[model samples]
Target: MAELSDGVAIRTITFSLLSSPGLFFTFLTIHYIYRSYLFPYLQPSMSPAHIGVAIFALSFQITNGIAIGGWLGSYGPTTSSNWAKHDLSVYLGTAIWALGLGLNVWHDDILRSIRRRRGVVEKGSGEKVYEIPTGGLFEYVFFPHYFTEWVEWAGWWIVGGVACPPARIFLVNEIATMLPRALQGKRWYVSRFGEKKCEGKKAVVPGLI
Candidate 1:
């Protein structure tokens, strides 16, 4: 077996590499909750359902984490033939995800600017109107976060040279869980912003979905 200069076994290296996405996603879920939900709650008023959604998101994240761990643990490492020689696709996909994440930040900043300009006045529902987000990704897609997430993990699989079976399993699980949530969120957006705002925007994927 090929050995590292430090005498680390190739199996150890491969296993660790395969497990990286699981750990990364775990960290992301933690940070996402704190930043997205906890920070919003620090204000005087926030809807109970918003908190509930946060909890639900965390719960799903936990399930996914466990699934990833089990998958990686079972597979341990990917052999060469297990995945196609498409390493370039892995890098390209990762860059796409990074761009999506950057756009997410940009979208948030724009919302913050709008909120600041509009001032923080309480709405009739006792919640601040248009405080979170409802344009760009929010308007165009219900779960851009999840979209980016799937893209990110797709990159992880590519980079690790993981095969299609595990990737398809994850995809199926995401569609089962997230698709309904996306549809619900789309309905909420339409109710709030009107059908005009959501025009030409698909629920999850763009066209061809």
Candidate 2:
């Protein structure tokens, strides 16, 4: 959004700066950079379906970014609206974002440490290991990473305030898409470890899903 950040209010500038790559730098970007080493079992070759999904996801993200950027630059709040009055929201959002990101990284590290200890694939057999995650929020939910991501974006929405449709849509869309995937992941865990082992853990939400 550097190209569009000429004369936006300080609030908008700060919001964009934090919510831009800062929202994902701790997880998504880092994860993708080392994805090959981390997930050696994944094929190097991309299928047509993979390409299609990538195109669609990229397009959607770019469109969403533009929408949010445009709103922050022109259509949304400015200093004229007495931004100081809304400081609470921005402060609260920043706290929530940090908390969410910390939890996400911690949970991810737990899984990675497990992989490091147990090894990703068994020798000779070439079978992948699937361990049930423990520690922190994993004791309550199957997909704490996904849940914390939703939390991160929920903070994004709060920082943008109630009037920002783009921020609301962004957070809502993330939940809508990730929720089903989290559910599927829970089912996969159940299939792998059996229903008995996964009895207490919910999909994404604790005691809910």
Candidate 3:
């Protein structure tokens, strides 16, 4: 029910737009546009469960976005200079977001290139298969993308501050979903290639989990 002053609201929105989550969301929109529409990559035919999960994921992001905006709008400006007010946390979040996005894109490129080299193609069933990625973060984590995503959200939470309820909600939801998926990916890899091949790799986090 608390509302920021008009001037404070304008400054907050401006800062938020220039921050990590905003930049990442912009990049993600473009990335998906290219991946889903412009690229000639074979699309996976989604199962019903997959569709449901995708919907839920999209919905969650939208809800989190709204919540974050509302939370920011309720907070007053901390300093006269807008940049100085959010400098540290915003910059930290941006760095983490950039790293995560880079790693995710790099990993995907590796997977796609490997599939191409192996002559893997989509079947009539609309399923494409890829070999296990072995370099970079993949060398340590079974699902490096997932791990990076968590790191990105951690940065977002840091910028949003612990006092923001919506920020906490986003962090918790992300971990709950991504952790399970990372574990599932690990299991799949183990089942396909045997435990010997995946012996040293952790599920999502390195060495800790």
Q: lDDT per prediction?
A: 0.55, 0.69, 0.64
Q: How many clashes (backbone atoms < 3 Å, residues ≥3 apart in a chain or on different chains) does model 3 have?
A: 0
Query: For candidate 1, lDDT tens digit of each residue in 131-180?
Result: 33566665656556666555655654454344534555655676687778
Candidate numbers, best lDDT first, in rank order: 2, 3, 1
Best by lDDT: 2
> Is 1 or 2 the stronger prediction by TM-score?
2
Give me the runs in candidate 3 sitting further than 4 Å from their true place. Answer: 1-49, 76-83, 118-130
Clashing pairs in 2: none
lDDT of 1 at 181: 82
> What RMSD does each model have against the real structure?
6.5, 5.7, 4.8
Once model 3 is optimally superposed onto the true structure by TM-score, how far is the C-alpha of residue 12 displaced, in angstroms?
9.3
lDDT of 3 at 61: 70
